[model samples]
Target: EKKDKKDKKEKKRSREENGAAPKCADEKPAKETRVEGAQAAGDVAARKAFLKEHRMTMEGNGVETFFPCYTFAEAKFPAQANEAIQNYAKPTPIQAVSWPVIRAGRDIIGVAETGSGKTMGFALPSLPHILGAKQKLPKVVVLAPTRELAMQTSVEYERLKVNQVCLYGGAPKGDQIKALRTNPDVVIATPGRLIDLCDSGLCDLSQVSYAVLDEADRMLDTGFEEPVRKILGMVNKKRQMLMFTATWPDSVERLASSFLRDPIKLTVGSTELTANVRVKQTVEMIQQYDKDKRLLALLKEYKVGDNSRVIIFVLYKKDAPKVEGLLKGRGYTVGALHGDSSQAMREATIAQFRKGEIPIMVATDVAARGLDIDDIEHVINYSMPLTIEDYIHRIGRTARAGKTGTAHSFFMHPADKNLGWHTAKVLRDAGQPVPPELEKYGPPAVKQVEKTCNISEMAPAPKITFDDSDSD
Candidate 1:
């Protein structure tokens, strides 16, 4: 009887294999879960677990991460990450969009206003790529427009445990060359000095697979087109490319077309420039002579003790020293930073500001961009910036790290009458009501006046300036 049962079971299995259900058996086959891999046992599982937990915190979709990626902390990155990197939050709007694209080894052209965390927008992803690649270590090159930008990038890049160096002018060339000797994984440089290093055969950029042109619009404005082109030609053609800028102009577009291949256009300006919502915008109108007094009054109201922070911006380098001197004399503990100051002084002043020893900084437009000082509670624009772009950068110092901030601008007598239309347009874009009080001093060239020039269907008409082309 047992022999007969065995024969019957074998016949049933054959039938199931032949596209039919077993005649007697009613259960399905059981499978075992394999939690190991070819390289590292359980690596895939651990990675999935880590990413599942971290992805949400890092990508809070603006609701969670309100400020820039001042710190890589919110990402809950691996504990092996350097400690200095843990104090700041996750990525900004532009950084979040660009990080994945860069990690995928794709080209990207990011349009974010200055002080919008554009530096780390590409740096974070590229750092890991260069550090983690199992293949030959590839170099990542970042080209910034000015010395200050190079230093800013250096500060963030150094926060990572990876090997990196900054090579730019204004600092001693010997020290820069010494840093380069380490065979760094990343290089932050200016277009001019980078070209010089390439010519000297001191920097081997042929193996550089990731190339970034930070502040692309500024590069074009400063006439670094030829130098930038030469640097781009040296890096690997099969590598990734990224360009970030505050404003997207024809020059930036042309450079993007030349450098990046089918680049992804990641922009926060869904409708217009006003979408740079990380900054707080305000206008304080007063008489020209009362500008100084009103600024003092605003400072008094803002109240920066040893804990709070302030960054005051002046239009000209001449005004930087003047304002700083006066503020210091008034027991405000202020310092002046401008292009005229030596690199050492600039760095020292920045250090003092960072240490909170100097609570207030009076700077010019040259100090406007590429600065990453954080937790600034107040941005007092003593005078309105000549360029709306400068205004954006100045105010961006505040409202960081999920913190509310104040940006006070003086639209004193001269500015209300003299400031350009674009400045007012920026205000309108911010959703802030630009009261007629801002235009208290006077109107532009032409004004409307009622006249009895029987025209259309009325007996009176207001004369308006109209070119033939302006007519619809």
Candidate 2:
């Protein structure tokens, strides 16, 4: 017995010296047990405390064995990937806990609001996971809702020295086919375009072992459910799936049950529809006809002509160009991002906005979901979105990367009354003052409106109709 114990100790030391990955205390299956550094078995109390402090609720078969990391060093990713992660001051709450679970080779369902550094949370783990696979066999595939988000995810993988090919609608298909011939390690694509390529026999997902569904809720909401399901069906059966969403809805729950196997659900904050607390929300009850003047006044009040960046969110594609023309006529350097813009135009506009050359951008909900520019100082809602969920995502564009921002909304009665109660609840939850005009649309006010209109109940809010042409 003494000789056997000595031999095991020497083996462990040798493995450590050679930088082999560590296994969880209670080992799982072959691919489902490797973690970064060995977690301290006695740190159960501290791990529980960390989860509680972040308001993170996690539950699954092997979730209790997971622990949180305060720094990237604890993640101990391969040296090539470690350098990029170390550049950040510290991991965001979602990234901190998700990395440990992901590195342990478990499928995870991350429920966190936008601008929570979710991209890096999943991107960082791809390095170590792909290192063990065959050379350029397409080990990883990330399905995003929009082309902008797909490109953003590709940029993250590029930073980690991972060769990637982006497949989206708008770009030249010939160029994409050529890149695919190179057998890139990663493919970040939109569902529709990816399916098209697969049907054409130019791309193969047979060897894809790591798959990610980024912005999955948006994919379902935008009428891409069939495409998403078809693409998932083509990938390897033994793959690990990772899904991240801003809200936890029944639709997402059903989809998760269908594809994921014994997954861990991690919710960083409340599952209710809530905007980022760092944003200061202000509602102005004004006339619909006077909105153009009010927008100009708000622009002057916020001094957007200065170095700060601002995004003006409109409701429709037709309105995006009009708003852009209005801002440009007033001598403001501006750009427009919508479904109507060509791929090159969208890319150039986003690049200029990121560089601060174009300080103001007129955009619709297409820019709302996963557009991650961290320096936006303000958000001006030119019109109320059809749903409160979209309103939260619009404002989420600002106040990113630990910075505070302001959001101004023009609320016109009869047009926006459907969202009055919903808007007030979001304001109250964030501790922002609720205006009396907007407050009257609460439950009691709903009754008042029903009584005056002589109706049994108010009609539900109008549903948002998305364009099916641009799947991204």
Candidate 3:
């Protein structure tokens, strides 16, 4: 009896040293006491400090138990998935904190900045989740907002050696249908095309147990909310839902409440809408007619032809081709990307841009979200977008992956003033100088209500400027 007792104690010690929980009935009380003590003191303080240092905010139940991984080994991902990420020494803040929560089969709403490694954060966990399923017939579904994002997502997942297919509207449906028949383990798709396939009996989502809505805010902004809702309704009711977005809005909150069950919300940075601070933003107030000339001047200053890649964002499809022609006529090689471009042309242009064959591309908001090209030195807003949200996404094309870049905008008042009001505040928040002309369009002051008023009879709007230091 003495020898048996000693052996049991040794086994318990070995398990504890390996970071496993004690299985012996007699050892449970001691282990519980130690964990409770740590949780009440050192553990809580250390977790709080770590989250503060990384600018992370976590909410909801089960978040206090969340532990972050610094190195790839600490994450303890499956051997197959680990092999694909061997080149990455450490996970990003989003990726680091998400592994444990997601692997535990908890639904999550992740809000992080763009280029923050959100794709890998969710993808790594899905690999093991899908592998554990009994039969793989589209066990995982990732719905991206754009075709480029969907294709890029598929590329990332394929690296894990998982059989996957990408579905989008701009491409040929025949090929997608053929691939769908093969019973892929994962389906990376856009909402429109995926809905079309489901309606026609080409795709079956009934067996899908995992669904990811990548860039959920953008998806809703682009009029895909109804289709996304329909797609989610088609999936299995007992599914795990992962919703990730760069910004969190009321619309997303409503959607989350409807679908996710007790999801843990993880935010890596501030939830307020703000541009990437790494991009130096400059608003050049000019007449609408002077924009064409000013664009050329700015390009020359940036040395675009000397191996500098720049993206010029326009507000309309009609302007994309015209801007492309203007650049080509000026002895510069350029490509145009807009809603009207065929899928083949869009892919070809992106391929050329990636290979350095075309150093400049004039594009619309369609290109703003998901072009994976690196080293984009500058982003020029030839025509300011209608909303400040769009402006943030356009400028986000630059200043990626720890590299500093610049965004220059040709701001025309009266036409762009509505958006300029919020834009100025965004600039001030980033420590960038807000042009005085654009600053004058701030919100109006409250005045006595008039029974009847003419357009010219109203009082001039109050001039406002945001000073972060003065804001308490």
| Alpha carbon lDDT of each predicted model | 0.67, 0.82, 0.81
TM-score to true structure, per model: 0.72, 0.85, 0.84
> What ranking of all candidate models by TM-score puts the best one first?
2, 3, 1
Evaluation by lDDT, superior candidate among 1 and 3: 3
lDDT of 2 by residue, 279-359 (tens): 999998889789999999989988886888999999989999899998889999999999899999999999999999999
Q: How many residue pairs collide in each prediction?
A: 1, 0, 0
What is the alpha-carbon lDDT of model 3 when measured against the actual structure? 0.81
Q: Which stretches of candidate 3 lie over 4 Å from their true place?
A: 1-46, 444-472
Cα displacement (Å) at residue 452, model 1: 48
The whole-model C-alpha lDDT of candidate 2 against the native structure comes to 0.82
Which candidate, 1 or 2, has the higher lDDT?
A: 2
lDDT of 1 by residue, 1-472 (tens): 9999999989888888899876546676656433211212333333333323322112111111122222344333445455644564556666654554455455766776556677767776675657556543337899887777788888887776667888877777898788778778888898888788779988888778888888777776648888887888888878788788777654346545666564555555532444245566777666667877777777788787658788888887888888887777778988788878998999898888878988888888776666677678888888788756567767877775556677888875554456645556677777765757654433347655444211122222222122234333
Of the two candidates 2 and 3, the one with more favorable lDDT, higher being better, is: 2
Across residues 234-334, which tens digit of lDDT does each residue of candidate 3 receive?
99998999988777765456545666777777887666777778899999989978988999999999998788999999999999999999989999999
